[model samples]
Target: MSNKVILVVLDGLNYQVARDCMGYLNGLIEQKKATLYPIQCELPSMSRPLYECILTGVPPVLSGIVNNQIVRLSNEESIFSLAKSQGKVTAAAAYHWVSELYNRAPYDAVRDRFTDDETLNIQHGRFYHWDHYPDEALFLDAESLRQQFNPDFLLIHPMNIDDAGHKHGLDSRQYRNSARAADIYLSNYISTWVDAGYQVMVTSDHGMNDDLSHGGILPEEREVPLFVIGDTFTHAETTVKQTELCGLCCQLLGLEHCKPYAPEMIAL
Candidate 1:
């Protein structure tokens, strides 16, 4: 089986918002017959740290990526580096802080100096707003990248719904509209990839509260959805918490020896 994986990060996406789109997603799930896991996101439920954890299979304490602004390197190497060592092709495209922290020019400079034949593409763009409707351009760009690179691993980050929720509270019409927009865009992307025979994994960095704010360890902010769709996946529901997701991705990608956070359930 080709261990191709696509990771999609929906920035600031709450479980409730995902639930709202569940009808659409459920149909896709049935059509694709993919596995679904409800995973808890990281603590503080912020962006940078959560992405770091997903990329490295280690917590912020070990990855030294604790927030959205600053980064410090810990001993743990990222999954990107690990994939490179295994001769697996990898590609990434993201918006906002997650992309910024990982694809910093200085970091890229150093990586380029040592790595060849490894493909990493990071596109920067603004979050949601009519002004950025063309932001869907990123998806088109990513599709082009996928065709060109045919990477074993691919990551895409979409940020508008989260941006809207943060600015206008989760219940606002704007937030709802943004959520709907995200659903449309995501559905299109996943369906396209599924037709192309790629296994797609979708999740969020962390969730937001009804008030559209979070930096706490609350369940509303930490609970996120994890869904896997493709021929490679077996359709079933598994209760997977956030920390366990990194390891699960590694497993799905044929890196069975990779270490993952021990599964632990937090009371809702």
Candidate 2:
């Protein structure tokens, strides 16, 4: 456990939504338990693009990821690849694209796929697409994996907030509640990792619009929230960009140095 790291992406949480609904996270920010940055995501502001951007430290235009429709990752030196090369185990519990991304990697990944009545067993804590709580299984699955595999790097992407946003739009009661629900679920996982001397980095892929839709570069859609917390985390006042996220994770996890996307934003 020399370089343990947990990266949690809350999918499509806007900065304002997180500030308003994620009370525990806010407490960390206010008390300086964590560093919070309102950072810039790429244009198009889609999950796939932002995910790739954060992983490769490359912009969407250069990485060839522009929207939800695209999934191919051209950048060879990803956080996953770097960790895997160093003999560090990596695991991810997330959306289908996660499987698509890790198809060839040695990483263990569980997708929050849509399930049927016969396939989904609530007694086993599994649910389906229409359940509105499909992501709860993700956290449970991740915990189980953590105990069994003892992975060095864990990436958890919860989808409930994204679902709620698309269905009811931002500023709706459902949207805010969904954000809170994600916060609650993430708190459990964060505590588990921190107790084991792991560093945690939480960020959003993109923000949302009035209709909770995101596909452009408007400030609301492009500004995502970032939080890095751990026992060894430095307390500093600095802003960061979405592309700089990969470097930040690498630095915190003691991995090979990846240059910051915005050199000016890094804290000395």
lDDT of 2: 0.70
Error of 1 at 29 (Å): 3.3
Candidate 1 stretches greater than 4 Å from native:
30-32, 72-75, 99-135, 261-268
For lDDT, the strongest prediction is: 2
User: All candidates' TM-scores?
Assistant: 0.81, 0.84
Q: State the lDDT of candidate 1 residue by residue for 1-268, as single tens digits.
A: 5577788877777777677755667676667555456677766577778887777767776667777666544345555656666677776656534434444433443333222243432322222222243437656656766787777777777677677778887667776677667667776678778777677877888877777787688777887777677765555444665666666556666664556633231101
Worst 10 residues of 2 by lDDT: 116-125
